[model samples]
Target: MTANRFTFRRLDLQDMAQASRIHRAAFDNSLPWLKGLHTPQEDQWFYENCVFEQCEVWAAFSPDMAGIIAFKTGWIEQLYILPDFQGHGIGSALLRQAQTTFPHLQLWTFQRNIQAQQFYEKHGFIAIGKTDGSGNEEKEPDMLYEWRRAGS
Candidate 1:
């Protein structure tokens, strides 16, 4: 499908269910350590209250919601797309939108998620730090990536 098929927009409270579904599905599928970590209901509740509350969220919709990217201050808190929509430009679209909005942005990705690392790197993000599974709930090794505007 062409990029024209997708619409990007800021999301609100009404979009909670759809956005949470993408978030839960993407993480649950990609992260081995996250399997069974939380019930679907628990995840939804957390997404709405914790994740949604903390960030400004934008979604890419292929008539229906296909993906979302959420960020706050200088941090990209979340980005997720449905598995069926993975290979398309939905993720790139969302990240481009986020990058345009935040001249400098940073995010954390699990060390095991190589696809994510590669994607971010392709978009000009560079690893700035690494952790030994101490600060996050998942208790897994993670890396921090940062993107800054040229000459900034």
Candidate 2:
């Protein structure tokens, strides 16, 4: 799909539910620690107390679809696109726009998620380090990625 086919808008309080759902869905399998857990209350809390203020959430919506493609960009936060919307350049568009405000950007992805790593690399983000966010080395390893503006 072309960029013009969707409209990008700033996330508002009214979009909290949808945004939370999108976030949970996008990170579902990538973060095994959260597997089988439904934390809508926690999600709402984070969206209200942390996410809404610290990050800028943008959603790309198509009139033909019932849901929106959402992404949140902040200090060390991420750009998450729904599974159904992946590989369509929507994530790239969101990342590009986020970079306009915060030129130096970074994000963490699960080490096992090769597709996500490749996607970040394809968009010029370089792996800088790794961490075991799950606290158990055998479970989940998170890879840190950073992107510096051209010539920087």
Candidate 3:
């Protein structure tokens, strides 16, 4: 899709379910090893209770919900684009939206997700730290990334 084609806006309660679906699809596609780790119900609950309650969620819609970014303060909790929409600038647009909101941001992605690593790095997020699988529920190694506005 063209970069200007997508509509970006804040998410509402009615959107939590679709956001959960997008997260599951993108997460499983990127990290197949973790597929089925969470039930659809659990994902929905997380979105409604944790994500919606804690962060501000914004989504991209190229006629449909294409991607979402959940962020708060100096951290980005989630950013997922539908697999069908991957690599089409939707993700970058959402990420840039988040960057524009916060002067600094931090997020974590599984170590094995090379595409995500490269994507974040390209957007100026640097690897600040890493950890073995033990620290997270998935028990998978992860890399911590941070991005800050120039002179901030």
- TM-score to true structure, per model: 0.94, 0.82, 0.98
lDDT score, candidate 2, position 71: 34
Q: What does candidate 3's lDDT look like per residue over 46-150, in tens digits? A: 999999999999999989998899999999999999888988898899888889999999999989999999999999999999999798999999999999999
lDDT by residue (tens digit), candidate 1, 40-146? 78877877898789988999888999889999879999999888888788888888887888899999999999999999999999999999989999899999999
Per-candidate clashes, comma-separated: 0, 0, 0
TM-score for predicted model 2 compared with the true structure: 0.82
Q: Which model scores highest in TM-score?
A: 3
Once fitted onto the true fold, the runs of candidate 2 whose alpha carbons sit more than 4 angstroms away are 29-33, 64-76, 134-139
Compared with the true structure, what per-residue lDDT tens digits does model 2 show for residues 18-106? 77777777778465566656587787777766777777777777752222333344344646667777767777777777777666877
Task: lDDT winner between 1 and 2, please give it.
Answer: 1
Span of 10 residues, lowest total lDDT, candidate 3? 1-10
lDDT per prediction?
A: 0.88, 0.70, 0.93
**Runs in model 3 with CA error above 4 Å?**
none
